[model samples]
Target chain A: MTPISFPDPDFIARQTAKMLLEVKAVHFRSDEPYKLTSGLVSPVYIDCRRLISYPRLRAALMDFATATILRQVGFESLDAVAGGETAGIPFAAWIAERMGLPMQYVRKKPKGFGRDAQIEGVLSEGDRVLLVEDLTTDGGSKVKFAEALRTAGANVTDAIVIFFYDIFPDTREALAKHDLRLHYLATWRDVLAAAREGNHFPPETLAAVEEFLNDPLAWSGANGGVDRISV
Target chain B: MFDQLLECLNEQGAGVRAYDACARMARARVSEEPDNAAAYLLLAYVAQRFVESYDDQPLSVEAASEEFQQFTDIVKMLDKAEADASADARIAALNVVAAKLNTAPKTGD
Candidate 1:
C-alpha cells in the first residue's frame, strides 16, 4: 500500500476523523455520559482500538501517522518505537515496522513477579524511542510510559497517538514540562467538524457535544462526574 | 521459535505471522520474567491463532464464535495450570517462548 504522502495536517486530521466515523468507532452519549479514568464524565468516547479489525483503513491511518511523525519529528531522529501497555502495542508494532525501528512495550507497572520487567521487548540504552498509543485524553499515560522508557535508558523525547482529546489547555504544557512532544492525527475538534459536515448526528446532539468540548470539566461537573482531573 | 512461526506465517498466512510475532515478543518477555498466568495467556493467544486456518474463513458467525470460544477455553486452562504448579518457576514461561523458536491481539475496557 502506498503512503498518502499527505503533507496537510488539516486534511489528515479530517480524513482520519471521517474514517473513524465511518467505522462507527466514534460514539456520542451525552445523556449517559461515560466516566473516564481521570474522573471526567465525557459525552464523547472513541474506540481507536476497534480500528485493528479493518486492515486497509488501519494501514492508511498508520501511513498518515508515519508521515506525520517523519514530518514533525524528523525521519531519522527516532531509533525505536515503544507502545504503552495493551492498547498502544498494536499501533506501536505497525509504526515500528513502517519506520524500520525496533518495537517495545511498557507495562503500566512491573508484572510484580518473575522477571517483573515493565518493558517487554529488547530495549537498549540511549535508543531514541517514540511512545505510541491509540489515543490520549489528558496525556497522562504518555508521561508515565515515557518515564518508564527513559528510566530504562531509552531517550524518549516524543509521543504519538491516533487521537488526542485536546480539550484541556494544560495537556500540552504538562507534557512539555516533562520534555515530551505530542503528535497526533486527529482530535475532538476534527471529529466534531466531521460530524457536523456529514450531519452524522442531530443538531441538538452535536450542540451538546460542542458544549462539552467547550468546557469538559464544567460539563462533567454539571453532569454526574468530577469537575477536575487528578491524573 | 520465531523462525518456526515466521515459516508458518510465510507458508500459511500473514495472520499467523502477525499473531506469532506478538506471541514471540511476549514469550521473550515471559522467558526473562516468569509470570505463570501471563505465560498461559501467551499460549492461549497463540493457540487461538491456529484454531482457524488463516486462509479459511468460518462459514458463519456461529463457526467463528466457536473458534473464539476455543481460545477462551485455552485461557481458562490457566486456572488449572496455576493449581498444578510445579517447582520450576520458569518452566511455563520458558515453554511459552520455547514453543515459539520453533515458531500473537486484544483490546477493550
Candidate 2:
C-alpha cells in the first residue's frame, strides 16, 4: 500500500467542503428553514451520509480522515477505532482499516446487560479508543458516546468527525469537559467558503445561511424554531 | 454486526468480497428463518449497489426500466418483511433500511 500523504489541514478542509458541495450533500434554504433535532432552525443542512454513495469522494475523504487522525492524534496513540452507532460506523470502519486497528461501535443505548453492553466488538480495559462520527453540532452526542465508552473501561480522550458545526460557541469547551479532544476535517465556514467560490446558491440564500450560522439560537427564535437550547 | 458489513462494503468498494459478505449474511439469515425480511432487505441494498456501480455508463431505456422495477420489487418485499418480522433488532434494522431507501438518491438524479 502507498504511504498516506498528509496535506495541510486547510487544504483538506477546502477539498472536503468542495466534495460535499459537488455531491449535493449540502442544502441551503433560507425561505423554508430546516429544524434540527436540537430544535435549532437554520438555513443550512448537511447530509454527510450522502458521501457513502459517491465511491471516489468517499475514498478520498477516508484517506484524508486517516491522515488527519494520524497527524493530529498520532499513529500509535490509539488502540482501537469505535464509531458512534449508525452514521459513524462506516467511517470508523474505513479509518480502522487504514490504521490497521481493531474496530468497534458504540451504541446510542445499551443492549442486553453488562458493563460492555453498550459497545459492540471487543473493547479491553484501558484501551485508548478513538470515537468517529460523521459530524458534530453541539458535541452533545459525542459526549454521550464518550461517556459510554469510558464506562466500559476504554480510554476515549479523542473523537473525530468529517464535519464540525464550529458555529456553536461552547462546543469545544463542552467536549473538553468530557475529556474528548475533537478533530474534524471541515466546518460550516469551509462549506460557506466553498459555496462562495462555486457560486452554488443565490447571494441572498448564502447570506441567510451565514446569519443562521452566526447566531443559531436567535435565528431559530426569529424563524419560529426553539429560541433557547434546553439542557 | 451490520456495522461490520457496511465497513466491509465501504473498505472494499463494490468488489466481490463486499458482495460475498453481504450475500453470506443474507443467506445465513434466510437459512435461520425462511421468511426473514431483514435479510432480503440487505440483499436488496446490495442490488442497489450493483446499479450504482454502473452510474457512469449510459444504459438502454429498457435496461434502466428493468433495474428500476427490480429495485421497487425488493423494496416491496422489505416492506412486507418489516410488517412480518418479530424480533426487535430485525424490525429496527428494517426500519433504518426502509428510511435509507426512502432517502436514497433517485437514478440519474
Candidate 3:
C-alpha cells in the first residue's frame, strides 16, 4: 500500500461532516424529533449511505478511512476486510481492493448449517478481520456482526464506520466489552461543529440538535419520544 | 469433536487456525460417514466461503461466469443436504442458500 500522511482526527471529522452536509445527508428537526429504532428520539439524523452515491466524495472518504486505519492500527495488521451486511458492503469492497486484501460480508443472521453460516466469503481461522459499516447509532449492530465473525473463526478486534452518532454515552464501553475497537471518520459533535462554522442550520435548530446530542434520552422524553433506549 | 469445533468456531478472534480445525473435523466426519448430511452441509458452507473470497478479484467475463456457476453448484449441494440434515443443519443450509440467492448473477451476466 502507498504510504499516506496522517491528518488530525479532528480535521478528518470536520471534513467528513462537511461532506455529509454538502450531500444533504444530515437532517436536523428539533420540533418533531425522529424516532430511532433504539427508541431514543432525536432532533438530529444522518444517513451516511448517501455518501456512496457521490463517487468523488466516497473515494476521498475511503482514502481517509484507509489512512486512518493504517495510522491507528498499522497497515500490516489486517488480514481481510468484512462489511456488515448491506450498507457496509460497498465501502468494504473499495477498502479491501485498495488494501489488496480479501473481502467478506457478515449477514444480520446466519444463512447455513455451520458455524460460519453468518459470514459470506473465505475467512481463515486466524484472519485478522476489519469490520466495516456505514454508520453506528449505539454500536449495537457492530457487536452483533463482530460476534458473528468471531463465531465463524475470524479474529475481529477492530470495526470502522463512516459516521457515528456519538450521542450515546455508553457506546464505547459497550463495544469495549466485546473487545471490538470502534473507529469512525466523524460524529454528531463534528457535524455540529461544521454546522456551527458553516451556519448551515438556523441557530435555534442547531441549538436543539446540540441539546438532543447532549442528552438524547432526555430530549427524547421531553419531545414525546422514548425516555430510555430499549436493550 | 463437533462440540469442540463449534466452540472454536464461536469463540471470538479464533482466526484461520480455528476455521481450519473446524474444516478438518468436518471433513473427518464426512469421511467416517459418507451419508452424513450434516457433514456435507458443513463442507458446503466452507466451499461457499472459498467462492466468496474471490469476489474482490478483477475477473474476466468468463471467469466471473465460472465463479457464479461454482456458487450455484454449492447452493445446490446445500439444498440436497437439507432433506436429510438435522433441523439445525437445515436452517444453516437455508441461510447459505438465501445468501447465495442474494448474490446470484442476473440472467445474461
Q: Higher-lDDT candidate among 2 and 3?
A: 2
lDDT of 2 by residue, B1-109 (tens): 2333444433333222234445565556556656564555466465546444432222332343344354445545555555655577557656666666668645554
Q: Report lDDT per candidate.
A: 0.73, 0.75, 0.73
True contacts kept of 3: 0.00
lDDT tens digits by residue: candidate 2, A61-139: 9999998888989978999999998789999998898888999999876899988889999999999999999998778
- For model 3 chain B, where is the 10-residue window of minimal lDDT? B54-63
On residues A129-212, what C-alpha lDDT tens digit does candidate 3 reach at each position? Answer: 999999988787799899999998999999999998887778898899899899999998999999999999999999888888
- Order of models, best lDDT first: 2, 3, 1
Candidate 2 is graded, for docking, as incorrect
Q: Between 1 and 2, whose lDDT is larger?
A: 2
lDDT of 1: 0.73
All candidates' TM-scores? 0.67, 0.67, 0.67
**How close to the true structure is residue B56 of candidate 3, measured as C-alpha lDDT?**
17
Kindly provide the TM-score obtained by chain B of candidate 1 when compared with the true chain B.
0.38
Q: Which residue segments of model 1 deviate by more than 4 Å?
A: A1-4, A112-116, B1-109
Candidate 1 pairs with clashing backbones:
A115-B33, B1-B100, B1-B101, B1-B102, B1-B103, B4-B102, B5-B103, B19-B104, B20-B104, B100-B103
lDDT (C-alpha) at residue A159 in model 2: 94
Model 1 / residue B36 / CA error / Å: 30
Q: A62-128 in candidate 1: lDDT tens per residue?
A: 9999999989999789999999877899999999998888999999767655332688889878889
User: First chain TM-score in every candidate?
Assistant: 0.95, 0.97, 0.96
